[model samples]
Target: MTTRTFTNRLTRALRERALSLVDTGRPEGLVFLGAAAGTEIAKATGFGPLEKVCKPVIAPSALVVALRDGELGAVDTALLSATGAAYTVGDVILMLGGGHASRSVARLASGAAAFGVGHVALGALMLRSGIRPKALQMSFHGAVAGTVGGMLLREDRGNWPLATYGGMLAALSALATSVDHGRAPSASVLAVGGPVFLLSDGLILARRKVAGGSLAARALDVGVIDTYATATLLLLTGTAAAARSARGR
Candidate 1:
């Protein structure tokens, strides 16, 4: 082969390799690896149920593999939400195991950060779909304000009402955004998952406020956890399917 042709092929190969590296280093991989490492550390220390950490992390990692050949699209939001969920669940696990208060705070903060980012991701999706960007932006603004106000109230007065309502509204807004845009069917999956998540989270918050330990609270807790897990699974898998299908088109 001619030297120029050889050089061209070599450059193309290198470019592909770089792209592969970039894909592997995305949020899904980073989150999975970080969680895996943390779980290992926690196990070594005899801290908690490491299996609980593994289950949720597996879905995102699998999604990264499934969508490796295409653009991630709004799946980025799903991955992030999954990561947040991992932290939230981990916080519960830590608390149940009587872990440190500081650690619990850190986990809760991670979940909060995820909630904030999910709104921005939804806005970006709306823009891409050529939907009502202005309306979506307004929704995003309201969501952010609600989140901030709710966090402040929780911190200052230990009130959870605002936070619960804010979360429910954000979830509904996400559903509406996904449903309004006809760009992809994966979004439809998101639409369904949103309300399921909202319902589960709302029930969990209600149980918390009820000063539980009753049989009803215990049953509700079990249902919420299962429902939330189902929602997360739906989101992660839907995102992967969306990315793959989007690329196919």
Candidate 2:
């Protein structure tokens, strides 16, 4: 065969292989696609503009989840998504009301606290339903990392409150992770969702510490992380509900 023909064949083979890897129904493929889409969306909207659009984009994911899970399954799923929406709105408020830094911080802190509460509630529900998570070590480590990162990124005037909220969020996330261990469909969802949630928060904090005009800072500050985090959370809750429903049948 000619060299050009051989090269073309090789390229096509490689492309097909890559596409196959990414097109699977597995959790890994979902994560890969989610992250890639998130990155592109972040770039397109720009950080500030993205926040304004986040709530609308995320609401539909929750609705689809509710529909798939059914009325009984929708309860927890709806609660989870509602709390997430509240948090997103709070974040947007903080971003828009930039002139009132202290008030904005307070609003953000309140939202974080609410989100943390939701995590704790979800963990409790999982435990009540007899799901025993096997990843305490992972959860603990995540909590520690979140605490340190929160402290490092604490705002100047609102340091104490913001750090406290950050620590709370981290702790709640760890609890949720621990509760997600042995569950079926939801377990897989949380496996990826939990870490991405942490990444989203960490990036938000990091952006606050960096220069606003820089590319890294803009990326960090974008709604993409929040969008991805919320979407994964919906997936986690929805899958868990679906799993329970399937088992009940």
Highest TM-score against the true fold, candidate: 2
Q: TM-scores, in order shown?
A: 0.48, 0.61
Model 2 misplaced stretches (Cα beyond 4 Å): 1-51, 66-78, 98-104, 132-135, 142-157, 179-182, 222-227, 234-239, 242-249
Lowest lDDT sum, 10 consecutive residues, model 1, at 97-106
lDDT score for residue 156 of model 1: 54
Q: What is the C-alpha RMSD of each candidate to the true structure, in Å?
A: 13.5, 9.9
Clashing pairs in 2: none
Against the reference, the lDDT scores of all candidates come to: 0.47, 0.49
* Per-residue lDDT of candidate 2, residues 67-157 (tens digit): 3434445555555455546544554555455411223566657656655555565555455445454576456756676666556565354
